[model samples]
Target: MAEGGITVTIDDAEVRAGLARVLAQLGNMAPVMEDIGRTLGNLTEDAFQASGPGWAALRPVTVARRGSAAPILQVSGGLAGSITHGGDATKAWVGASKVYAAAQQFGMPQGYAGRTRRGAPIPWGDIPPRPYLPIQDGGLLPAAQSEVLAILTRALESAVG
Candidate 1:
């Protein structure tokens, strides 16, 4: 289970309408939700593989500390591997269950007073937002939105046929 996560709701009128129609005809949205969850999970994995397409590059200090040019957010692959998705009939969600997932996804500002066990600055420097989920500004990214719309269209067509 995730303490912090992104829930992608279908805000597009056309996609929402198509989904509503399909759900009405199918009489159960669970299957559709499952499909959406799985698709989103895969997309999130792709984001990790791409090292977050639009994310800022790793800082030189971070690279040196890591001892190599390992991708940001992938030092141990825990955050990426912790990604999970699930939904009931009404909603779907995708996110990582890692404790620091929120900080990693949203970023921590510099000069914050938080400290680690050794009394060092929690982040040591600003960690720019590196959104690994296929979402932006509270909605799925354009590509992801298109993929979801395709899924909804297929479901609608199947129900209609």
Candidate 2:
């Protein structure tokens, strides 16, 4: 011992005992450390893409008294279709007569294009009675006046609540 009760010599038994205690503690924390490492690797800058240049820093567009006088479904042949506030967001094979006939010919169940509240279509064997879009005949499907009135009433009640 060169200083106050401090021995700098190698002690084999003490070193082994300290190593065993440290290994036991690390053994319990190995899985937790691996999970934390994986989470840190996922949120890096190169992992996900949010939007293009200058997209995040722009304010959203707002328009009052919104009205567009076109029928909701128009064939742009691409993803450029625009819809205003009152436009029908639900456009699928549900209300199409050709799709209905094809489903019948292939022995598929009727009214397969149903949705949950979040608007995902149900499969062939699993569908509710009501579809997301109600069936329309030859002309354009006009919004029912009664349904609009009911919606307005519900909105007023919700605003009061």
Candidate 3:
């Protein structure tokens, strides 16, 4: 792709275009989707409380942004711990707290940091960086912003520590 060395596959470009379209769609769904996230959490809480191990075994567990990534907590007794994904950071995600510590401490092998408001890096490393939101106002967000923003926000909010 970098000027004439490796031949770029058609599928590669198709995937990129498809992702852009998805991002635009996500921009439209941002607010409502955020609410849906809350509802799912609430439903899980109620169901788990009502019945023992209601969703624990199958838990829709996704450890990283990519679905292919192996779950940090697949079907363990939960000392293994679940992972999160985020989008537009409603709570502090791309903030000054290293999420990796928790993953390491809890015995998670690997995880994703997720994205910021417009797909910027959230905090990382043993020392977390200060949260810097490139687009403070939602109106300033670009069309491509949603995919990263949406998932990362959810992940960090779910992680919280």
Instruction: Mark the regions of model 2 whose C-alpha exceeds 4 Å error after superposition.
Output: 1-98, 101-143
Backbone-clash count (model 3): 16
**Candidates 1 and 2 compared by lDDT, better number:** 1
Ranking by TM-score: 1, 3, 2
Query: Per-residue CA lDDT of candidate 1, range 1-161, in tens?
Result: 65444334446665567678777888778878888888889998998888888788878888888887767788898998899887688866687877667767778777654433354556658888988887766667788778878888888788888
TM-score of 1: 0.85
User: lDDT of model 2 at residue 77?
Assistant: 12
Cα-based lDDT for every prediction:
0.76, 0.25, 0.31
TM-score of each: 0.85, 0.16, 0.21
Error of 3 at 103 (Å): 22
Clashes of each: 0, 0, 16
**How well does candidate 1 score on lDDT at residue 25?**
81
Best by TM-score: 1
Q: Where in model 3 is the C-alpha error above 4 Å?
A: 1-27, 52-161
In the range 73-123, model 2's lDDT, one tens digit per residue, is 222211111111121111111112232222221223334443222444433
